[model samples]
Target: MNLELPLAELTALLLASVRAAAWLVVSPPFNSRTIPSALKALLSVAIALPVVPTLVGKVPQLDTAEMVVSLAEQVVLGAALGFLTSLLFSAVQAAGNLIDLFGGFSVAFAFDPLDASGSTGNGVFGRFYNVTAITLLFATGAHQLVLRGFTMSYKALPLDGAMSLHNLQHLLTNGLVEMFMAALQIAGPLIAVLFCADIGLGLLSRVAPALNAFALGFPVKILLTLGGAGLAMTMLPQAVSTVVDKAVTAVMQAIGS
Candidate 1:
């Protein structure tokens, strides 16, 4: 028995795998520490195999210098796309962070062992929202859509060409704005209730100083946040769906599709 592999095809597979691996490192759900690096590497290779045929002809000469450059380009391209997806999806967590801030849960912040970023500042609601969003993302099969968008990105950003930096800049700007806007929309009513609670406490404090209404502010706001959290979460499903579409569009637009 004899086995042989074409150099060009092998090179294409390697380059595609580099891109996929970088993406999985930066993208959410996949980026979680719960997934081992070895598994991610194997998954990257699996993802690359299907696209190898399309890329084989376009694979450049088998020069060491060119190969190094191609690898770097793929890493950068994959990380960019992954970051965009992560940014858009973080809106849900941001909404929860806002709730934590207003509800006095910020003081309960603790280290999250599973977070890739190693940030210790995510409060109770922040962590809760992040977990719920990930659950929804998987349950709704939105992760498949996101993965499909990433795989299709090869069509817009081929292995041989450079991505559009200007387009990436524009998308980054718009993505930030959208993230904040979506977060506020999801958490706005709760925030407003918390704000009004503060105002009422302030008034009571002035009108009846002996009653010490200001002391009740913390507990009252906490109860309001807990109660309104259910209402706010009612919007999360639709918000997640909209965010998936936006993330896919951003990835395509960034690559000039």
Candidate 2:
């Protein structure tokens, strides 16, 4: 038995595999630091193999210019999908930052291992909440939904078609705004409580000139912030659930449209 591929067929498969691997490197679950890069590449190749078969005879034979153009398109599609998944995590981090700012922990800074960027001191709870949300995302099969979206994207945005500039602009604008809005919603309750506490402290300081506002306000604010954080934990499940649902919906809409 002999098995050999023609030059044209080989080139097409290679192109498809490269495109798939590029997307996987930047997308979630597969893109995590915890996952080995080699494994992610391997999985991308595995997925691309089947997909390429469907396109092998259908897609045009590649020339140098065409190959370059197609490769660029694939890179854009992959990066966009990966960025969409990452937005959820970004929203979580932004919410944590807001909580820290309002909770009087802005001065307390710590490095987040996941972000590698400096996070707030009050972020311990926020980080824990993020982990829980990510866990639930996987446990509830939301990760599978993401994978399905990626697969469907090939059909919707075939390599031969021109990328839609309008769709790209809409996604960029709406996706970013939605992430920030979600973060604000998650942090709103705690921020409101902290605002009220500041007003109360202001009233107390005016009433008693001799009392050291600095000494009295610090402990009181810390206690109130801690209590608010504890209460916020009770709302985590519902908030996370809503966020994940929205993310999945956005991915589907992006790919489908």
Candidate 3:
């Protein structure tokens, strides 16, 4: 079968593909190191095809100056969307870090295989949380919600539409704040339990000066934290769902879709 398109149409398609690939390479679930680059590119192209028709007719004709500007705009837009989607993972990781901190695992560090980056204190927990969230994201079909957000972007911010720096900045700021809030909520229970435990340990030390507080408190706190984490695992699915929903909403709103 012969498949061909006019030069102009081809250029538009290529441009859209570039934008999609840029976003997919950085976004969660799609951007994971485990997913092959070839598969990621293929997925990006598949995503761009449905939206290409709507954009081709409206996007300006390819010219040196216009091409440069449009390409830059597309890259920026893709980055913005990718960054927004990544916040959910960041929130999960942050929660894990908080748990580690309050649980007295601050000195335990581990190399995260998924990120290929070093982590400190509760870094291992953070990485585990992120992986769990990503798994849940796929299981719940939240990835489709992310793709839908991308499609809606076309209507909110067309291919040739002007980029609103003010709006983008606002969205980015709001996303960061929300990420922090989500992390705090997920870690709150563990932190509260640990706090009370610490106070009780301090009182015990004051009461019995002969007792070696460091020797006994360490093991007790570790056990309590592990138990607390086990209990908290029940909430992981709900937290993952909420984070994905918030991320999708943020992306859609960022582009004013």
**Best model per lDDT:** 1
Highest-TM-score candidate? 1
Candidate 1 lDDT over 1-257, as tens digits, reads 88786888889999999999999999987988889999999989998899998888778778989889999999999999999999999999999999999989876754445554546578888888989888899999999999889998777777897888888888999999999999999999999999989899999999999988977887888789999998888888999999999999998788777
Residue-wise C-alpha lDDT for candidate 2, range 1-257, written one tens digit per residue: 88775765566566666667776887665666677888887887786777775566545556778778777777777777767766765677678778877776765545556445563344654556567666766888777777776777666666665546676667667878988988888888888888888888788789986887757888887888788778877776677667666666666667765
Model 1, residue 98: displacement in angstroms? 0.6
Worst 10 residues of 2 by lDDT: 114-123
TM-score of each: 0.94, 0.81, 0.89
lDDT of 3 by residue, 1-257 (tens): 99775866676677777778888887887888888999988987887777777777767666789888888888888877888788655888899888878876655564445434443335556767878888888888988888887767766777787557787788789888988998888889888988998898888889996897757888988898888888887888988888888888888778876
Clashing pairs in 3: none
Candidate 3: residue 206 lDDT (0-100): 92
Ranking by lDDT: 1, 3, 2
Alpha carbon lDDT of residue 121, candidate 2? 45
- Please give the range of 10 consecutive residues that has the lowest summed lDDT in model 1: 109-118
Candidate 2 or 3, higher lDDT? Answer: 3
Backbone clash pairs in model 3 (N, Cα, C under 3 Å; residues 3+ apart or in different chains), count = 0
